[model samples]
Target chain A: MTITLEPGRPKPMPTPETKHFWDGAKDGKLLLQRCGDTGRAYFPPRPFSPYTGTRNVSVFEASGRATLHSYVIHHRPVPGFTPPYAIAVVELEEGPRMMTNIVGCPQTPEALPLDLALEVVFVPMDDAISLPLFRPAATPAAGRTGVSMGVE
Target chain B: MSYVPGSVAVVGAAETTHLGAVPNLSEIGLAADAALNAMADAGLKPGDIDGIAWVGAMRPQLLAQYLGITPRWVDGTSVGGCSFMLHVRHAAAAIAAGYCNTALICHGESGKSRIAGAQRPPEPATLNGQFEAPFGPFGPPTLFPIPVLRYMKTYGVTEEMFATVAVVQREWAGKNPRAMFRDPISVDDVLNSRMIAWPFRILMCCLVTDGGGALILTSADRAKDFPGKPAYILGSGESVETGMISQMEDFTSSRAFRVAGPEAFKMAGIAHADVDHLMIYDAFAHLPLYGLEDLGFVPRGEAGRYIMDRNTAPGGKLPMNTNGGGLSYTHTGMYGMFALQESVRQVRGIAPAQVPDVDISVCHGVGGMFGASGTIIFGRDRPS
Candidate 1:
């Protein structure tokens, strides 16, 4: 017997509130809105500061480095996705709570190590947009060539 | 918390036909039917109503138009399965405060049949719909079952414990002619029922009942003037926790009850043992178990044990869900309304299937996904 995996469909167009994030993903970057003055990160991507009560905000690219806080293994498929998947809440290094999927590994509690290091991977849904998911990054050798960058 | 001891009198209570599927009726139509019946039950005309509160899937504006009232006060709190109970508390407080002389709390839903072509309600912007909705949890059966599974794991409870609740509720329903599933059921039957979700057999979940229920509240002094029997709402309380299902603190604990139960009991000036009858929203079987434990009816995590003792069944110590609940009776979508209606009826001594010597009735409704909870303690007399 053989098993085949079905590819999921991506979102068609970005809404006015989410265009910047989707556009950044197309450029191979994970974008988040950070307060220009207070340096606080906002989610559900709002125009004004949910915190600090300041209107100064900017869309900045994220490092997508985070720790796995907690997650659940869903045995059934949701709209636009395959079943037997892991849906997790990742606590980004920047201190924002994000809901995303875990990938590139078995979807089980044993394989999903809590507080494990992760890196972002972009999975394109439609022609013009994609999503930023995270997975376990490859461990480097004794002398690694590339240094990871962190944005201020 | 010291104010004049006020009373919330249920001068009116009404419902649609106690049967299955009434699809042709719009949400507003059903609400109107219930509101009118309630007014008639109270022996008051539509013109006498000065306040309105509703709970259901329908938007507030739509229900307002259905009731044909431009009231001085209005509340449309849609708390999933347990909204109607919440409305009773709100209506009671509003009546006590003199916000309105006559207030009506109404609920209606075509659970057996939804609007054929109506668009799906839009999800809130704050929700992580993109991430959460994709995991086969768009509705109640899937979302509610998660907590039940976790509770069983934490307490080391078994499906049989939950089945005990279902069997007992079904037995009560067997006596209720209005119950959708009145046939007698056994624990073995519940265990063998089809699985709606993990650990929740179809028998464990509420039936898709199509109906509506309404209650009219008035001040204690004003209630004495009414013609029909009046059930006094002696005390009421409400509490809410994290709104998102993904953000709930712990599946094993209920934040809403921890907050609301004490406040309600305190206001009622009664202990848990004082309650005569319990009419809890039976959206799912686990809810009553959670309610029993959360409201201090029994110790925490002992809900399974308390229920397993065969207490909630017919002739047991605590006769709960006497109307059969959504599991057997008509859920009517917003089941809280039914719970409140039953509570008022039980206290007024006019209920269709009366519980014996019922002077006090505690009505509870948990809206959202354990997100919010409300309780109203009713009695036959106002505190002297």
Candidate 2:
């Protein structure tokens, strides 16, 4: 028996509201927007604070530490992903949560326990895109290299 | 204040005759079939429908043209499967206010066959595509269940507890001939049913089928005149939280469900004990858990125990998902329509697996992945 995999993963296209966040990822930094009015951090960066809709916001480096909030070990095969990989949501230490894959660790229930400590790692796809994926904090070297450059 | 409680009634309801696998039919054809069936149930014709509301791939323009009736009111609200519930709510308001004397809300999706259905996965530019999809989730099987682990951790809920939901629903399905998977399934069967997503075995997910359902609404004054007994709309409400599942306010409770459920309860002026039959959308097994608690059927963090007690099973108190729900019954992608259809049947005292002496039936639906929600309460008698 033989198996084939899909060619490439879906890449995020940078829009006006999210260019800075993607740029930060390309450089191996997790960037989030902080609302100037409330001094609160938000994810999936936008031009203004979602809480008050004030343009008083600034981009900053995130500590890249997050707890494994919840996840599903997906078994269905698709073009760009291997079966039985973990698709997860990690709650950033900064308060807001975001979606990312948990790599550098086994994708099984026994291995990926809830609240497992994770840190950020960037996978460069092309010159312009790199997806920010998460990995176990203790074993960053265990997972394969990133698949993209974070830009576009 | 213009909307009156119990001012409108669902005079007719019908699901397309050809459900499960009808390969020859297009999405629009399924909608038309359901629309006509619903109208016939009401003893009505195209000319009798003054307002039309729909949700799905089929545009309302094409539907109006195909049905050959120009409705004075139109609604094409597409939020998810629960969009049909919202349509019913909007149509009820329109009918009560004289915007339209009669309203038709229909849903038809070729979810299983994809006949003439254009695949509209989240775009690369959309929030989902940019943030969630890039992580390699092949849509709902991966996305919808993402909140379970955190929910379990926060509320002491175990996988076995939610898995019991699938078991109990299958018990209800065992009696309904139209249900897709009717065999009595045990919790072990659900746990062992081939994992599609972690915490969600295939049995715990909705069955992909081809079907459509439609409802006809008129003023409560004309309720009993229809061929089918009318189910009066006691109250209805809808609310939204977030487009991105990760951004959901809390992992355990759905903000949309919490908001929509209570609003409907308040509008209906009914308490939890007043509900005789319940239909909570079960696109995935965990939904009923959220619906039960968020709708105030049980205290928070106790829905798991509530189902485990078999309170929602056949011959149990607060009978739920009596048509087997999306899990055991037919799930045509956006299953809110089917949920609404079953609630109407139960309230009209005509369900296939009829619960005895049902007066009020509450149908609750989750639209997106915990993003949008709608609730509708129906009753056998007019509001006081």
Q: Would you estimate the TM-scores of all the predictions?
A: 0.79, 0.95
DockQ values for all predictions?
0.13, 0.70
What TM value does model 1 have? 0.79
Worst 10 residues of 2 chain A by lDDT: A143-152
> If you assessed candidate 1 against the hidden native complex, which CAPRI class would it receive?
incorrect
- The digit string of per-residue lDDT tens for model 2 on A18-62 reads 888888888889999889889888877888888899998998898
Tens digit of lDDT per residue, candidate 2, span B1-384? Answer: 656677899998999988899887899899999999998899999998889888754588788888987899999998888998899899998887788999888888899999998567778877888898788878787889999888888799998997899899988999999998889988888888898998788988988999999999999998877788889998888999988898897888998998889989889989999999999999998999989999999998999999999899888899999999999899988999999999999988888999999999999999879989999999888877
Off by over 4 Å in 2: A1-6, A139-152, B56-58
Each model's lDDT comes to 0.72, 0.86
**Poorest 10 consecutive residues by lDDT, candidate 2 chain B:** B53-62
Q: Which stretches of candidate 1 lie above 4 Å from their native place? A: A1-123, A127-152, B1-6, B56-70, B116-126
Query: Model 1 over residues B1-384: C-alpha lDDT tens digits?
Result: 343334667888888754478877766677778888888888887678888877534466666666666676677777665666677777777776778888878776777777432325335232544434533354566566555645775688788988888888888888877777877888999999875554567888888867787788888888888778888877777888855555555666788977877788888888878788997777888888888888889877898888778787778778788888878887755687788778877888877678888878888888776888888888877778
RMSD of 2: 4.6
Q: Output the lDDT of residue B343, model 2.
A: 91
State the displacement of the C-alpha of residue A10, model 1, in Å, after optimal TM-score superposition: 8.5
